[model samples]
Target: MIPLIEARGLVRIYEIRKGPFSRPQPVRAVDDLSLSVMPGETVGIVGESGSGKSTLGRMLLGIDRAQAGEVIFDGRQMPPLHSQQWRALRAKMQLVYQDPLAALDRRLTISAQIGEPLDIHGIGSKEERKERVRELMGAVGLRPDQAGRYPHELSGGQRQRAVIARALAARPSLLICDEPVSALDVSIQAQVVNMLRDLQEQNGIAMVFISHDLKVVRNIADRVAVMYLGKIVEEGSSDTIFQFPRHPYTKALVSSVPVPGKRLQGRVILQGEPPNPAARPSGCAFHPRCPLATDICRTRTPELRRIETGRTAACHLLANDLAVAA
Candidate 1:
């Protein structure tokens, strides 16, 4: 089956201006990345902050145009940003912002905000839009009476639910959720994550769930992609990748996820500072911090290579077993 969305060789670069005498430095937020999401599939992208996960999400949605490569949606190339074609096509996809308070308009009631998508997409009449808004509120676990309240009137979880209800207003087939539950309390995070999973199952919507939390991603994603320094170091079925992470970066990230009722042992502690986009290291971008870094890792960029059926990783030491590396 054709993918609901496909991004090939996506590259997004930004310039950092320092001073009048200094030349601006170019930074690649997303570099040579490719990903695809099948219909009704949930793909989780996990990485620490500044790994370009957010940039990739914006590129996928055409909110931030890639400097190189292309994004195809439903067998068609993504139209130019803000074009009439893009505007109309947008009804099929939606974004769940990380901060619900910022995402929602304080001036508008929840009912109006949730129903705005329908109005923009011209999906239904006024009465029908109102009915759909109520339906979505219920679906996302928001009360009908709460629809008339402003964003600040609700708690963090309630605000997030309102955002989800708004995103579902047009019945989108694809949802690009960038750090959807990162800002919520731990308990609220579980509720939102489970709610998102249930919503996807019910509506058959494909989702690219981006977050830094591996435990949360593991619970919600069917497949997982681990990103580091603007590239996917490893990707596979969530069970396989999380249980047996291949790349050093992936291993470090997975080890950091806490397991309840047990003291963690042999956790891969990361070294050095977080990756600097403005001054990206040469060769393997992860070598500076990877414990398994050898001479080859410092000199050559490893291509993402297939390890087994439906699994791939970019690492110089893939031939050796992970135990040996440790």
Candidate 2:
């Protein structure tokens, strides 16, 4: 089956200048990364900050142009950014940001904000838009009377629900949610996550859910992709990746998740900060902190390859260890 969204060898770079007289240095925010999201499938992207998860999300939505590679949505290559074709295609793709308050217009009523997309996309008549907005409010668990409330009138969770309602107004086939529930309280986070799962199942929306929270990802994602230094170090079924991670970076990340009633023992605590993207390490970016790093890991970059059925990892040591085990 053709993927609803496909990203191939996507690369994004930024030039940072140290000083007025210094030449700008190019930083690869997103390295050559490829991923596919099937219809109604939720793919979780988890990593530490600056791992390019947000950048990857933007690239997938065609909001950020890649320095290299192409994104194909629903089998056709994505149109040029901000072009007429792209604008038309935007209705089928939407983004839910971390800060709902920031995403929403402070001056506009929740109803108006949710209906804005319908108006912008020319989806329905004015009366039809109003009715749709009403339905949306109800769908997201907002009361009819709350429609007139401004962003500040609502609580954090309500604000996020309003944002989700707006994103879904156009019925997007693919949704890229970057840290969607990160700002909410634990109880509210569970509510929003459950709502998202329900919405995906009901609308059959394929989602690229990016977050640093492994527990949440494990709860909502069909598959999980672990990224390190702008590259996907490991990817597999959510259960498989969480239960038996193949890559060292993935192991460290999974181990860091605190389990209830279980004391932290043998947890892999990585040393040192992530290397500067502008001056990435020679070979494996994680080698400097990896306990299993060998001379090969220090000298040659390992390619992401199949480590087992339905699982892949980019680590030389893992491949060698798996081979020896076999």
TM-score per model over all chains: 0.97, 0.97
Once fitted onto the true fold, the runs of candidate 2 whose alpha carbons sit more than 4 angstroms away are 321-326
Report clash pairs, candidate 1. Answer: none
Off by over 4 Å in 1: 319-326
Q: What digit string (tens of lDDT, one per residue) describes model 2 on residues 192-271?
A: 99999998899999999999999999999999999888999999999878888778787778787888897877777777
Clashes of each: 0, 0
Candidates in order have lDDT scores of 0.90, 0.91
Candidate 2 clashing pairs, residues 3+ apart or interchain: none
